[model samples]
Target: MPGLSRRGERMPPSPIRKLVPLAEDAKRRGVRVHHVNIGQPDIESPEEFLEALRDPGTRIVPYGHSAGLWEYRDGLVEYYARFGIRVASDEIVVTTGGSEAIIFAFLALADPGDEVIVPEPFYTNYNGFAVEAGVTLVPVTCRIEDGFRLPPLSALETRITSRTRAILICNPNNPTGYVYSREELEALRDLVVERDLFLLSDEVYREFVFDGAAAHSVLHLEGIGDRGVLLDSISKRYSVCGARLGCLVTRNRDLLSAALRLGQARLCAPTLEQKAARRALDASPEYLEQVLDEYRARRDAVFEELAGIEGVLAVKPKGAFYTVVRLPVEDAEAFARWLLTDFQVEGETVMIAPAAGFYATPGLGRDEVRIAFVRKVPEMRRAMRILKLGLQAYRGAPARAGDRAGP
Candidate 1:
């Protein structure tokens, strides 16, 4: 038999889902597992979104334009306008998901072996996408002490080389849930402009910010519109992950054309999803407000419980539904697997994503784990209790006084 190609061998398994067997084993053993691993929200999709699909006025289930339905695209224009991101419908190319939007941006802007700088401990799927594109991911570390704020602009400068093609950022970032301040975004803007690099902003969680924090879009930045590519989705915004409808928006005609060509190759994204997303754009802000309130409650509960844990350190996230906690254990991956495989509290356990997967550098994030606050408040509190109990069960020395609680 022929051996697999080198590229095939290079593909990395999804770190998020790799521990499923352990979870299944735990379940088979009669343990109730509280999942804090992935960011699948428990919120209901808006009624209007479903109603659009149920109306069924059209006779044909034809493929919409490769770029997506004009009405859908136009709705996105208005959707973005609410946040002061001005762009025409023609500038948008709808993709299968924000996952596809990232791939499309990479295909449009990068050649094999080119570099994209992403802050360390970023969204783990980014590693997968970079591997598939054969692009190098240069990571700039952001200290958890600073709530994983983008490291100083100087840190980003050291990673740039001639092959550097883009800078990718997740605003109200994944894994860490750090919402970049306006100053931080401006600092990034200056660097991207100076280096003549593409700026890719993943704003999928734009609506989930808390504590009166507002999200700033790179598209709204003054002169960088030509260099900016905004990756967005209705999945998180509308709690309709199954819809899998996302769009890549840019003011750069050249980039949009290149992305459109890639979209053409795929024919078109899901037609019904596009219609649902179109209706989702018209949903009242109140629907999102209700979801945000629930997430905020969950976040508060998780933060408080983590604070009470003897050896765990976590910051209060300003946005998104994830919290990165520093654990007392030496290797978070080992501890995470042990939690699902061996440890239990009242015949229940919590499954978490090992923080190492979020980092590009080997051996970093070894003592950290990411917990998603997607469950209801009561469940999140229970999960946190189990997490604390698991830590107590681990055979490690206690954390130092001030170190256990961050700055």
Candidate 2:
């Protein structure tokens, strides 16, 4: 048999999905594993969108266009206009998902061995995309103590080289869930403009802002309009992850032209999903409001419960449904595995993604784990109970603690 290519060897398994076999093994042993690892929400998709999919009159399942249905793209333009982002349908190219948008953006704006500056502890899949695109990810450290704010603009300046092509941000970010304030967005705007670098904003969680927080878009910034790329998706907004609908929005004509070429190669994203996405674009504000409220309540419950556990530090997440908790354990990966394989409460255990995967730097996030508060309140409470007990048990083992928390 032939072996895989060098790129295949360089690629690592998705850290999020790497533990699936263990989770399945636990299930085989009759253990009810409460999954807090992934961000797939349990909320219902909008009824109007579902009805659109179920309509008997629906037809034309064939591929619509390389750039997606013209109607859906136009609807998305209107959707953004509501948020003060002015753009035409021509500026948007529908993608299979935001995942593809990221890849296409990199392919369009960067070359092999080029570099992109990203804040540390960002979405892990960015690393995978960087690897696939054959680009280097230049990371600037952002501490959780600071709520993962953009590291000082000066810190980012230090990482820039001639090869640095862009700066990627996930506003109201994943894992830490820190929403960038307008001031911070302006600071980034100034920096990107001064450096002449591309500003790629991943706004998939744009509608999930809590506590009356508003999301700032780089595309909304004045001078940076020609250099910014807005990655939008209907997955989180409509709780329809399987729809696989996303868009790449920009006023940069050259970038859009290049990205369109890439889109043409893939043919078109799903046709039916594009129609459903058009319906989603016109979904009721009340449906999204209710979903936001549910997520906020779950965030509060997780924060409060984690606070009660000694030696656990959890930042109050402002936008997304994830919380990064700093554990007292020596190695979070080992501890996470132990929770799934060795520890159980009432024949159940909590599954979480080790924070190390979220960072590009080696040895960082060693004592941390990213937990998604996606389950219902009752399930979240049960998972927290199991985690609290696991922490206590791990602390009691003298060899494990080694004088860190030993009696």
Candidate 3:
């Protein structure tokens, strides 16, 4: 048998999906499972998006321009402009998804051994993308005690080295749901300029901010265009995760050209999805406003329930749909696995993502788990109830067994 390549060996499994066999086994036993593990929303996609698919207007469904369909890119120009981000349609390169947009940035901006500094506990798939691009992710730790806000710019600067090529951030971040403030964005803009590094902003959760908190885009920073790359997707924005369409927005012609070549290598993004996404871009602002309301309700429901669980510590998430929670258990992965394997409340259990794989540094996040409150409010309440009960049972089981064995 042939040995696999080093890259394949180095790849890390997704913490979000690693416990599938246990969950499947539970379901096979006729147990109900509440998924708070991944960010698959239960919201309906906008009517316009559905309508476009119902009437695709085209027969052949041929490959679009490698950059994207002209109409789709044009629609994106209008979409970004609404957010006060000005860009030419030519400057956008549509990719397979935000996942590919990230890979494009890594390939275009950094050499194989180069480093990209990111806040710790970032989107987990970033690890996979880093392996694929052969670039390193250098993490600057952020504490849940501080609600996972970006650390002081000085703290970030300490991580910079001669091989550092860029700084990446997720506005309204994943796993922690920490939204970057305007001051933080300005600080990062200055740092990137002083360090001569590219700034990649993943703004996929732009509209999911809660509590009237604002999410400032790196593209909104003055004079940062040449140094900024905006990675965006319609997946979360329109509840269209199946669409598999996203774009890389930048004003750097050199980077844009490189991304185009990569896009060409892949041929093009999905044509039917692009057409549907173009219609999605035109969805009324009210559509997003209503969606935001739903997420806000879900957030409140989950946060309130978490607060009731003794030994559970989590700051209320300000944006996005997830929160990294510190659990009472010594090993969160074990606790999460036990929920699927041994425990159930009225034949229902919850699945969660352990937080260790979201970090690059060893031994971090061993007692933490990330929960995506993407279900509706009632469902989230039920999941949180199950989570609370699971924690109680898990913590008391050993003590109870020991007491029974004693005189």
Candidate 3, position 305, lDDT: 91
lDDT (CA) for every model shown? 0.88, 0.87, 0.91
Report the C-alpha lDDT of model 1 over 1-407, residue by residue, as the tens digit. 99987668888888889998999999999999999898898888998889988984688888879998999999888888888889999999999999999999998899999999999889999988887888889999987888788877888999999999999999889988889898888888889999999899999989889999988988888889689999988888888888888999999999989888999999999998888888877788999889999999999988888888876778888988898889887778878888898899889999999999899998888889999987899999999999888887765434433233221
lDDT of 3 by residue, 1-407 (tens): 99988899999888899998899999999999999999999899999999999999987889999999999999999988888989999999999989999999999999999999999988999999999999999999998888898888988899999999999999999989999889899989999999999999999999999888988888899979699999999889898898898899999999999999999999999999998998888888999999998888999999899989888899888899999999887778888998999999999999999999888888889889999988999999999999999988888776432122111
Candidate 1: RMSD to truth: 3.3
lDDT of 2 by residue, 1-407 (tens): 99988778888778888888899999999999999999899999998789888982555568678877899988988899999999999999999999999999999999999999998798899988888999899988888788777777899999999999999999879878989889888888898889999999999999889888898998888788788899978888899999898999999999889888999998999988888878877778899889988999898888778889988887787898888888988788877887898889989999999999899999899889999988999899889989999889877765553224432
The TM-score that candidate 3 achieves is: 0.97
Off by over 4 Å in 1: 396-407
Q: Model 2 clash pairs?
A: none
**Candidate number that wins on lDDT, 1 or 3:** 3
Regions of candidate 3 where Cα sits further than 4 Å from its true position: 399-407
